[model samples]
Target: MEEDKFIELAKKAKYASKKIATLPVGLKNTALLNIAKNLKENQEKIFEANKRDLEEALPLVESGELKQSVFNRLKLDENKMRDMIQGIIDISNLEDPIGKTLLKRQLDDGLILTKISCPIGVLGIIFEARPDVISQISALAIKSSNAVILKGGKESINTNKEIMRVIQEALDSTRDFPKDVLTQVFSRDDVKNMLSLDKYIDLIIPRGGNNLVRFIKENTKIPVLGHADGICHIFVDESADLEKAKRVVIDAKTQYPSACNAVETLLIHKDFKYTTELLKALEEAGVELIAKPESWHTEYSDKILSYKLVSTLEEAIEHINEYSSGHTESIITEDNKNAKIFMNAVDSAGVYHNVSTRFADGFRYGFGAEVGISTNKTHARGPVGLEGLTIYKYNIEGNGDIVKDYVDGTKSFCHKEG
Candidate 1:
């Protein structure tokens, strides 16, 4: 597609988003239920498309062009489809974000001011081989009343098109939402077109490796809502409970080694007398420590780990500030004072205490499901959930009042409660 064409489509989606923002919660729920129903009804078709993608991917994997984990995340099964359906219904049960009055106050004379939640217009999502992300992003965008355009990787083009077809069918059945509100571009050239549609795309969220995020940041003028990597950390304070720390660290690192929130660096408060034993336990559990004079600055996404011994709270703070990817950081401490200090000092989107950093998820946070975990401070910070998908606007009300009386200092400002 040409750049101009995508810009035009994005404009239409923005126009559609305006209408979607005001849609009733019940109506949105109905659309979500219908989507779930359709997906369940057409399981065989979805699996067939997935099979083709898997077969084509096998040769690439055998040639060492694709990782097994990437291939697994790409190939969809019945459970993945069910999970996607449940995620849609889960968003349906959440409260409507639009028109939520976050703040209300009275101005001079009779003028009233209100700040409320509203949609951020159209969003562009570019993700890797996870074909199920198509539904996940679509559900969150619609629930929050934001239109979305998806650009999945070429490897999952066939699967993506199939899922997009099913979703568009559901949207078409509604007849109110524009079918173009959900679009999937198969061509790599379409990414350039998407980047050029900044005038209509309010935000660009890339869910993939560092190179893709860097490319989007450098090439696009639109706001990007993704972190390059998750160099997360877990600090064991001197006042920490040794047993709890051991369990949480195991869950954080060994539970799922490939995830972004998995612990990449371990910081030990030097006052902790059992630091050596803790390190030994981690090594016994198959964590290959990648330590040097300054290895704490590294992020290990594989079986690798980094060890750091801190003399004090200040040293732990320095390590986190020096190495963290600003994603998720946790502290395992029983002392309230130390926990407060660490929470205040760690510069991350998620600050956990007495818990694993792996718990940093949209579902775990009780927001249904996550489109992606974001480290951006402006739009979204932690899990990009339904609430994160919305931005607020001011809604003013007045009883036949104008700014003329207040501007000249002719009227005094008064606070009133209704």
Candidate 2:
């Protein structure tokens, strides 16, 4: 019975997805701006709802039923609330991602083939905590012209419900807006149903810890887009400036230790002159540095950092490629030659030089917001924004075009690339 209900809901979302796919950019922007306005107006109610969620989550955190990192994400502070509203408005200002011409080719004398960007039907979003994500994802979906079914963890159910309520009310108030564009589902069974109905859910985007992403990858036939771990790394080359290296490393790890982009591993060239000072600075910054550990794949999503000394830049790149999560990696160096080499050699979604890995964010990257940082080699990589959510379709225009005519040599394709 539960499966039937979910299937029905999925069908409606699929129907809604088609309707919104052709929506004009003005209407979409109106819907997004309304969502931002409604959220701004209902801040008090939303905070009250978040307070209830935090009250329930605290006991779980104390009993070890939930990690404190998750509790931090669960709590919706004033800054997060303000950012959430601003993100939606920012998205409304972004250029429309749909129906843009990607390619144009002359297939024949009168036949012209064009590739246009289009929505990717429906998106199934499974996230844990981070209720602020609801607004961001909803705004991105609206701007990208894709329907979404969001399944948030039970831990922040109250906050999720209230936020969704405001968003839905906003959508409802908008003129000529399609219904079922965003559906919020709960229960483990909803997850199972989402995984099973690959035809209905075009993509599965899981936003949470290693386990949740892995489980979605294992269970779903639908295409999954996300990174399981964020074992990011930062390497200090022999020519790295001591002061700049210290500042970048400190900000990367200690600025927001719980962030997925936070640097977890520190690598220093053996010949680096300021290695001792750099390590000392990190220790003074309250970072617990572990040296030469038994495992290299650990993602210490906390104040703890793992360190290693390598003889050369190649060794740092090699270590990063071996155990790094392919999320993000950065190199600190004054030598432009070595910096170029490090940036090219590191096999991660994001590679930086003379900067902190914390800059590997969509909002910081000026994408307004992101669905998530994807480590996948194909489709999309790094921070996935509006353009990432769209796929292209080929269309041919001709008075009379037949495959048989072209196959029989009566006519031929000009094959002009544009």
Candidate 3:
């Protein structure tokens, strides 16, 4: 599409977003339910589209042009289809995030102040091979009453198109749902265009590799909300239980290694007695352990894990704080004091104790679904959900209230919370 065409789409989305922002909760839920029902009824068509994507991706995977992880993510099985349909329904059942009263106060008689949650105007979502992200993100956007413009990876273009078509059909069938609430772009040039349109795009969320995220952040003036690198870490304290450590580390590394929350670095106390056994267990579990100083900063979204032997808990924390991407970090220790210290001192979105880093997910956190995981310090962090997509605005109600009266001491203001 031409640059002008993209600009037109963005303008339409901006207009639609304003309409959605004020929609009642019932209408939004109706749209979500329609989407879920349509997706379920058309599962076969979606699967056929996914098969085309997989067929194209398989050759690239064999030729080493695409990673196996990407290919696997592109392929949609029965289980993934079921999950996708169910996810939308789950989102429909979530509490409405908009129009919630966050604060209420009485400044003076007949003068009231209120802080109410409202939707962010527009969202720009760029994601990689995972076609499931389309439905999940669209559902969240609708539920939160925010408009979204999506750019999906070329590898899953066919699948994305089909899913978007199904979702659009559902939205069209429902009454009072605005058009252009969800739009998708399909070119690298579109990404460039998206970055430049900060006026229409309120937030830019890149859901892909570190390189993609870093590039988007560097190029865009828009506030980017995502983790550049998922360099997660796990530290084994001296008082760690060897069996627990092994179990947690193995699960974190092997359970969907391509996931962003997978453990990439392991830090073990030098004096820990089960270091040898833990390493051996990980190796036996098909984890390729690399112990090198240079490997500390790498996010191997695979079965590869980099490790180091630290002299003390302080050394472990220092190493993690220095190399971590501020995504997720865990400490395996039986000591309550050490656990508390580790949890408090680690400045990351998710800090866990005696558990696998894999638990760092929006769905697992019971948020229904996530737009993306964020490592940003401001706005939203961790797994971003409906609340993250919203910002608050102050509403003041008064009858002929004048600032001059307060300035002139004619009216004494008493700030009281109710």
Q: What are the TM-scores, per candidate, against the unseen true structure?
A: 0.92, 0.98, 0.97
Worst 10 residues of 2 by lDDT: 292-301
Candidate number achieving the greatest TM-score relative to the actual structure = 2
Across residues 283-399, which tens digit of lDDT does each residue of candidate 2 receive?
999999999777899888888999999998889999999999999999999899998888888899999998899999888888888999999987899999998899999999998
The model with the greatest lDDT is 2
TM-score (C-alpha) between model 3 and the true structure: 0.97
> By the TM-score metric, which is better: model 1 or model 3?
3
Per-residue CA lDDT of model 3 for 1-418, tens digit only, reads 7899999999999999999999998999999999999999998999999999998888899999999877766788888788778878888899999999999999999999999999998899999999999998999999999999999999999999999999999999998799999999999999999999998999999999877998999999998889888889999999999999999999999998888899999999998999999999999999999987475788778899999899988888888899999999999998999999889999899999999999998778877779899999997999998999999999999999999999999998899997
Give per-residue lDDT, candidate 3, residue 390. Answer: 93
Clashes of each: 0, 0, 0
The per-model lDDT (C-alpha) reads: 0.83, 0.93, 0.92
Worst 10 residues of 3 by lDDT: 292-301
Measured over all alpha carbons after superposition, the RMSD of each candidate to the real structure, in angstroms, is: 2.3, 1.1, 1.3
* RMSD in Å for model 1: 2.3
CA lDDT for candidate 1: 0.83
Error of 1 at 202 (Å): 1.0
Ranking by lDDT: 2, 3, 1
Candidate 1: TM-score? 0.92
Estimate, for each residue in 297-331, the C-alpha lDDT of model 1 and write its tens digit: 45556667877787998888887888788999889
